[model samples]
Target chain A: MKLLKEKVMAEGIVLGEQVLKVDSFLNHQMDPMLMKEVGSEFVRRFAGEGITKVLTIESSGIAPAIMTALELGVPMIFARKNKSLTLKEDIYVESVYSFTKRETNEITVSKKFLNADDRVLIIDDFLANGEAAFGLARIVEQVGASVVGIGIVIEKSFQPGSKLLKEAGYRVDSLVRIASLENGTVTFVEGE
Target chain B: MKLLKEKVMAEGIVLGEQVLKVDSFLNHQMDPMLMKEVGSEFVRRFAGEGITKVLTIESSGIAPAIMTALELGVPMIFARKNKSLTLKEDIYVESVYSFTKRETNEITVSKKFLNADDRVLIIDDFLANGEAAFGLARIVEQVGASVVGIGIVIEKSFQPGSKLLKEAGYRVDSLVRIASLENGTVTFVEGE
Candidate 1:
């Protein structure tokens, strides 16, 4: 977490006190070495929770989720943002609104991948309004699986997402948390 | 490669003569164990190519590209389909036509990720008409980076993608090459 915090402070771009763009390292252009460490940290935090699968939404979440799944020796299931031609029609779908893009898109996971017997860990790149995380959690609930925990790479603590998940009684862990992004600078949550 | 071939034969769904869906393992619901093997195989194939970076498009390609980047100890960059607000406007963009989706999406990679000195190894989940791969190659070329090779998980050899890459003198490697998908059954190329 310290390494991630340092990386964020060094490479993260704060835009207008709301968006923390980590495209240089965490999201768009990824540093797999750092990601592998992040995956290891997630495994360290949630390995004993009987996680049979790692679940994340597509695109950004796939990398860290894949790395975590690799570390945990479990399969990973990513909810698709848009229904692809190859994805089966019979899927557990949930609608998620992106505050950034200001559009609602349905996230889906195949019913074939998740089941009642599985215990899942939800992972994602960023946690802002928590719409994506809750949408993924809904899909897990629909499949009758248990969500062991949620792993996040970057959490905008100034926002409501992580707090919302905690209030829902879900254990959420973020590698790098931004406490405040006031005046074009980022402040990390002290001692977290 | 044998493991990948077996996975495709067992879990891959042949939607029609043209479409083979391996989302159950390779893309959507991923088997990280098998994918780790796939990554190792890619490293085995392209390890000596001096690849400074692993390049792929967003969504499906991120997993394998992540694994390969981990194996190679290099960074991976994914081209974004939608221009993210976080992404810089000065980007290397290319228009890619998806035969399956029947639409053109412009993929952009941040100008910060690639440079003239970089040697990129392009990786993707599927190679059909080679539009995505070519589009990625164009981005690499735009940055003045050399594309060392292109590694594909599944190649629909019946399509023109692989042939197009080969004709262009790009080193093309596919784990499983479908000779034909006739009668709704996959027929792999005889030896490789």
Candidate 2:
């Protein structure tokens, strides 16, 4: 978390008090070493939860989720943003609206991968309005599987995502919590 | 490679003469332990290439590419399939036609991530028509970065992807090469 916070402070670009661009090492360009450590930290936090699978949305979430799944010795499943040609049916689908892109895209996970007996850990790169997290949780619920916890790399605490997930009774563990990104500077939540 | 071949033989579903569904391990539903081995294998194959970066397209390619980057101690970059609000301008864009989906997508990578000094290794989940691989290569070339080699998890050797890449004079290292998928059977290229 310290390393992630430091990386954010060093390289994260704040745009107009809302967007944090971590393209240098988090999303667009990834730091695998950092991802490994983030995975280990997620494992350390959710070790005793009996997680059978690690679930995440595609693209950015794949790196951290795959690393966590590797550490925990479980399979990682990424929910596709769009329906693919091969993945035709028997899937749990949820509609998520991205505040950044201002568009709603349906995220899907094949029913073949998740089941009622499985315990899942949801991981993602960033948590803002919690649409993506809730959408993932809905897919998990549709399959009757239990969401043990949610692991986030960067949580915009100024936003409603972290609070909403906690209110919904899901354990949300974020590596770094951003208190504010105002005036072209980042502020981390103290003692988190 | 032996282990990968075994996995393909065990879990890979032959959809037809053309499609090989490796969703259980390689792409959709990922095995982290297997991916770790895959990353290490890629590193072993392209060890001395001085690869400064690992590049791939979004969604399917992130896992293997990130793992390779982890092993190589470099950064991994996944080209976006569509334009996003955050990543707007100053990007290297290439149009890739997905034969499976029957559509063309414009993939973009920020110019800030890649440059002329980079030695890149392109990694992907599958190699069929080579559209995705060539698209990524063009982006690399746009920045004047040299593509040292391409690492593929599964190569449909019966298709033109391997031949086309080889013809283009790029080193193609595939973990498992499939000879054919005729009559609902998966056959591997002998001695590969």
Candidate 3:
């Protein structure tokens, strides 16, 4: 967590009191060693809940989620943003609106992957409005599967995502919490 | 390679004569251990190339690319299919046509991550028409970076991708080469 926070503070770019551009190391260009550590941390946090699958959105979340799934010895499932030609039928669907892109896209997972017997751990790169997280959790519930917990790499505490998930009774664990991104600077939430 | 061939014969679904759906382990829902082994195999094949970075497209390519990057002790960068809000400028762009999705996506990589001094290893989940790999290689060439080799998880030898890439003088290493997908059966090209 300390390593993630340091990398964020050193490389994260803040824009207009929102939008942290971590393309240098976190999202677009990734540090594999750091991601491996992040994965180990997630496994350490959610060790004994009997997680059957590690679920995440495509693109950014795949790196961390796959690493966590590797360490935990479980499979990783990434919900597709668009319906592809192969993944066309018998799928659980959820609509998520991205505040960053300002567009709505339907995310889906094959029904063959998730079921009542699975325990899911949701992981993502960033948590702002919690829309993506909620959408993934909804898909997990649609298959009668239970969400064991949610693991986030970075959370904007100034936003309502962390608070919202906690209020809904989900155990949310974020590696770094941003208190503010005002005046072209980042502030971290210290001491819990 | 034998393990990968066995997985393909066991879980890969041949849709018609052209499509092979590997959503179970290679793509959508991923087995982390298998992917780890895949990374090791790729590392073994492309070793001593002095690959400074690993490059791949987003979604399916991220899993194997990250693991390869982890073992090679380098960074991994995924080209974004769509231009997000944060990734708007100073990028190397290439248009890739997805034969599976029947769509053309403009993939972009930040200029900050790649440059002339870098040696890149391109990795992908599947190699069919070679559009995505070509696009990635073009992006690398745009920045004056050299592509050491291309690593593919599955190569549909019936398709023209492998031939095109090899003719272009690129080192192509495929874990499993499929000879045919006829009559609802998966066939592998044995012994080169």
Candidate 4:
């Protein structure tokens, strides 16, 4: 977690006190070395849990989820933003509202990929309002699968995301927890 | 390459004689173990080209691209199909026609990510009509960066993607090359 927090301090950019853009290192452009360490940490955190798979949303979360799945030695299933041509008919879907984008979109994963047999760990890049994570959890419930935990790379503690996921009884582990980003200065949650 | 070929033959579904869906093990649902091997093979093929960065389109390509970047010890940059709120304004953009989605999408990467000093290796899940790969190549050209090679998981050899890329003088490598899906059977190309 220190490594990730340090990374956010070094490379992450603050956007007008609310948004933290980490495209330079975490999301758009990935640092695989740092990613492996983060993946290993997720495996360590949810080691004994019945993690049958790692689930995430498309595009941004795909890379880190893939890395965590590799570390956990499990399969990864990503919910697509739009239905692709080859995807099967049976699906588990949920609508997630994005604050940054100022819009809502549906995320879906095929029902065949997830089922009652899976105990999944959800992973994503940013956890701000918790809409995406909650949406993925909803999809998991729709498939009759158990969500073991949620792993996040950078979390905005000032936002309702962490509180929301925890209130839902999901173990939310954020590697970098940003408590405040007032005036372009980032402050990580003390002792976490 | 044999491992990949075997996976394609077994898990890959043939739809309408023209489409082969390997979502179970490739795109939607990812097998991290196989991705590691595929990534290693990509490094073996193009590591000597002095690739400063690993490039790919978003979603499916991010997994293999991360694998290769991890092995090669470089950063991975993905082109986004939609300009999300986090996307930078100063970007190199290209329009790509998706054969599967049946529409054109603009893919963009921030200008800060790539420059003339960068030598990129483009990786992707599938190469059919080559529009996605060409789109990435165009983004690279826009930044004055050199595309050293292109690696694909499955190549529909009959689709003219490889021929078009090769015509542009880019080194394109596909792990599994499908000669034809004739008579309800797949015929793979002799060489990898």
For each candidate in the order shown, give its overall lDDT on alpha carbons.
Answer: 0.91, 0.94, 0.94, 0.90
- What TM-score would each prediction reach against the true structure? 0.98, 0.98, 0.99, 0.98
Winning model by DockQ: 3
For model 2, report the TM-score of its A chain.
0.99
- Per-candidate DockQ values are 0.84, 0.91, 0.93, 0.89
| lDDT (Cα) of model 2 | 0.94
Query: lDDT by residue for model 1 over A1-192, one digit each (tens)?
Result: 888888988998888889988887778889998988999999998867989999999789988898899899999999999988877588999999999988999998988889898999999999999999999998999988999999999999999999999999899999888899998999988887
iRMSD, per candidate, in listed order = 1.0, 0.6, 0.6, 0.9
lDDT of 4 by residue, B1-192 (tens): 899999998988878667988889888999999999999999998857999999999899999999999999999999899898778599888999988899999999999989898999999999999999999998999888999999999999989999999999999999889998877788898765
Instruction: Give the Cα error of residue B82 in candidate 2, in Å.
Output: 0.8
Which is the better candidate, 1 or 4, if ranked by DockQ?
4
- Give the Å error, residue A132, model 3: 0.5
Model 2, position A186: C-alpha lDDT score = 94
Q: Report the lDDT tens digits of candidate 3 across residue range B57-155.
A: 998999999999999999999999999888899989999999888889999999999989999999999999999999999999999999999999999
**Candidate 2's residue-wise lDDT over B1-192, tens digit each?**
999999998999889899999899977999999998999999999988999999999888899889889988999999999988889999999999999999999999999999899999999999999999999999999898899999999999999998999999999999999999999999889996
Which window of ten consecutive residues has the lowest lDDT sum in model 3 chain B? B183-192
Fnat scores for every prediction: 0.85, 0.92, 0.95, 0.95
